[model samples]
Target: MKYIVFFIGLTVVLLFFFSSCSDSNSDHENKTEPGIQHESMKAKTVGIDFAGHDFFQPVSNSISHIHGIGYPNNQEALFIATHHGLKVYSNGIWYETKEHNHDYMGFQATSEGFYSSGHPEEGSTLLNPLGLLKSEDFGKTIEKVSFYGESDFHHMSASYYTPSIYVVNTVPNSKLGTGLYYSLDGGEVWMQSELEGLPQASAHSLATHPRLAKIVGISTPEGLFLSHNNGNTFSLISEERSIGTFFIKDESILYVTADGEESLLEQSLESDDTKQIPLPTLSEGDSILYLAVNPLHEQEISFGTVAGDVWRTEDYGDSWSNILEKGNVP
Candidate 1:
């Protein structure tokens, strides 16, 4: 009787587990709501409410420049990297991570986890300039992969096609010989990348192609540069837009934002024609700070501004939905 009871209980638990997983998986797909807190925009949680979860609240009312934006492996939430820490928006709610309040400079979200290079939070003895740090458990804890105390990468990016990582090492690591470091083995090993024809080694922003690891697009003070032979050589693509920052959503499409420009330029690698689309001006003199495209949903794109305002467009820039604004937390 005891054995039969145990078997029955186990079977019931398994059935419940499977049922819950199936329901959860379907929930995200069925969610038709476009933006966060679509029904109630004025709802605000009380002070310091988030705990025992992967969420926190930004202490400041306004936000700094959004360094990076990405969705994790599950694509259930969008992660925003600001000067404060990692902020996640999911299921019509805004959540912030309490752990590791470091200023992530070179932030990138991958299916594996979050990778960054930045300064450590106050009261922590980790390092002033953290190089190649990763957090697999959603910004709860970060571990150093390489160049812990020696270097900082202001512009760093990882490729989705292959295990390739690139960074413009601002601080030279004596062992690594800095300028541009490339890691083919997922940050396990690093070496100096060949930047033969590039006018400027420093980059304001850099992006690796989604389909080819060899292809890279860099934005500098001079202009935008494209590399086809895996950073061995680079050719100047355009100097007309005064490209301040750029990101490659895929092998063909490169989204760019120029300095002091209000329009977002969507440039195609296959064609010389580019579309200059104006972003929604949430506040006065608002320009796009960073842009990110969902790997799972290629058409879905998200961009934020220095004023802590975020917007999303799901239909290839046909329309947009405001996610959140400064001083307003959902």
Candidate 2:
């Protein structure tokens, strides 16, 4: 009787997992409503959200100048944000979206779609400087948030599941002045953070909690600091010299530093514990520039390098697979 009951329980659990997975994939599709971008009394975007086609062509020379990297809500594939546009990697293959190539900068992926700032392509009806745009269909249908043509945020970090936004503004613009700014109401309103506990050195990079609206991080040449109060203040997390690049995955902050030998470390948010993930020997003059964690599969992580190299590890950094070499498809 015990054995039979155990078997029955296991079967039920497996069924529930499969059912949830099926629902997960369709939820984003059903919830995605087409969006429009309006600027100067003109339609900024008129592209179809889904082309009604499920086909993609293999692409090459699509990985250089990578600004950021991400995975869609479903974690079906990894998307590379580049100066030319967005390229995708899945099942050991690289593909590109036709006619949607735009200079994507400060890209942040979310549970629904993705957010970015950059310039639109030639045929794009949207404003030249994609001040801030949200794609409900992964860059097909874009919705204007703010700063339509005023600013192209180069350093931005936003919540993966919330409307919170934080950016390190390097230039002053109409909607924002140069400094650290954040918005909790989905870009409806904004506020500036005082950066109380951050080191005096220049902030090199930024990261934010995936679900928590207030949790954020900043890395400098001196150290890494995290803020629970939305950048109003911060607490020192690591003093390792940052190369101005890092990312957040769930409850941990993963960062890299150039201390003699380059290294990547994951630090727990709940404690001071830190452990290093194996490093793939990088060529001289190259450093990890961007990172993305598969939300659904935490063990799977990927990163892009300054030299346009990309690598993935499905077993939580135990091993790595080089997907792109110097921005080429091979």
Candidate 3:
């Protein structure tokens, strides 16, 4: 009888231990990490058709993990941020900025000059100190601005109508404060803006309408924020979602992309109203990274993804056509 009881007790203990282990593993899979979420992502072959012009015909040299994209005024040049430095595409020619070895994180161009921000070096100085570079002759050369010191910049946007004013988002270190900084004299000087009503979140994207200088939008990890008084104050516009890109066609219409999702959101900037526009769905393994909209036409926009997918939308975000597939145009 003693042997029988002991055997039964051992069986019960083994069953309980296995059940607890299985439950723990299940919980671990369901939990999400900070600043990251799990979702169904895919990569697909695509092309970009813009106003009867196909931009995917030209074979690209290499897609160097683009960090930002901009088109300057009075020139048919496309500026792209790369890990090595800034790359410029003008009149079917490509040029790279010299003497800068930092990773270009964001870019903003104006009639007088262009601005880019990134880390001075990778790894040890990512948050402690960051660098901002400026160029005048279309990425031929660059100069470092002396206003802000050692601040990690995440995103930057220049005013198209008002080129003198620019905004940058920085991650404050334990020694330096974190917030939005505005430059008025073409990045010659910078001042910390008052972010009273905006969420205390790091910014991922910054965009300013061509017509509305006072209205500016920012994409942050927490959500989206908009400022009407030129960064004096801000208001929360979207809930907690990772915003990768933001574009404002007019004073009333806005578009944004959420991280880990292929769907684009079209919202009314005048009020608290929004509508989701369907985009060309990515394959089962792709994820979008950034998006850009043409200033001349509200209906035309472009987006880049992790799968090296470049897509363009002629009818806004209602429909999309692929421009380049993975490894098609680097």
Candidate 4:
């Protein structure tokens, strides 16, 4: 009976040793072989807002310039332009489109569709011309339409009253004719507006008044231009100061950012007169890259800077608060 028990114990030890050796060999093979199992690449989280605090999230890979950002008219989706392609954030999911070789310039949304434009990319060559794209499903997809050859597009504005109509400004390029183009048929075709009173400088931003369909404002390198004839003609409001980003609350009030100043201007659209309103002070410069006014409250406004700081104003630009701090998001 003792001999039988010893033989069984010896058999069990040999079996255990062989199984351990086999498992070790399998792990070693996976480490050495290219097709064997391996850890997956980590995903990138570029930016995050936690409990109202902004944080910088890093990406494992580099990306192209973020030329533009747009939000849908009726949805919470945000569209970002990256060197890789257009990135859409919707319902907590991020999706990237195939690279189209274009530098996304500007974006606008309407009830009928969404509009965007950029410089075209072909192979290794990049064309500074305007290429318009449209999407009906809140940027779930994009389709190229008319190509304004060689002219660089700097600004775009969608008509609030007429959803199917939009306008874009082209910088003077050697290859492409520089000016503005109006698309009345939802980007299927475009016609140049020969507005006699339009300014000659490049238009950088455009906005239409919410209540007045004929009242529009264009921010150019020279100054601000007003159009009362539905973009058919334009006239300079004030040429003494260079206007950067601008927002129109109504036909009576206009908010504009002036060059070389940290304060924003509250001007009357009726008289083109201005009053400088100081913005919130920051350790970094007070330069603002973009300004957005609350759709419901004209007194509430948000301004973003190149240093990644976002400032909010609640009392009609009289006082401001920094909502986002610099170096908090990358």
- Model 4 scores worst on lDDT over the 10 consecutive residues at 1-10
Error of 4 at 295 (Å): 2.7
RMSD of 3: 17.0
Q: The CA-based lDDT of model 2 is what?
A: 0.69
Spell out the clash pairs found in candidate 2: 44-126
TM-score per candidate? 0.75, 0.82, 0.64, 0.59
Find the number of clashing residue pairs for candidate 4: 0
- Sum up the clashes in candidate 3: 16
Where in model 3 is the C-alpha error above 4 Å?
1-60, 74-77, 86-102, 111-113, 119-130, 147-152, 164-177, 201-203, 238-242, 257-260, 273-276, 317-319
Residue-wise C-alpha lDDT for candidate 4, range 1-330, written one tens digit per residue: 000000011011111110011110011111221111123223222332212222212223334344444444433334555434454443344445443534555566443445666544455232234345655543333454545333333356665336444444323233223345556555555655555575554344567664565667766556777877666777888754566667666555454545564457777776867787767776645456556554434566665555545566768767876644552322
lDDT of 1 by residue, 1-330 (tens): 000000011011111110011110111111221111112112122222343353465434445546678775435467887667777766556777665667777787766666787666667655456656766566765656666665656567887646688876533355554456678877777766677666633344578886677888766555678888767788877754456556676645555545464556777787667777656655876556567887777777787765667898878778887877763653
Off by over 4 Å in 2: 1-55, 60-62, 123-125
lDDT of 2 by residue, 78-187 (tens): 88888778787877778777656778878988777788987776666555566777776666557777776656666788898898888665445666556678999877
Give the lDDT of residue 159 in candidate 2: 93
Question: Residue by residue across 1-330, what tens digits does model 3's lDDT show?
Answer: 000000011011111110011110011122332211233222121221212232222323565566666655424445566665655543434455443445665566554456676554343322213345565554434454532234434456777656445544333332224445666665555666565566554455567766566677766666677888767677778766766566666655444545554457777776767877667878677666566665545576676666656677768776776655662442
All models: lDDT?
A: 0.61, 0.69, 0.52, 0.49
lDDT rank, highest first? Answer: 2, 1, 3, 4
What's the true lDDT of residue 224 in model 2? 79
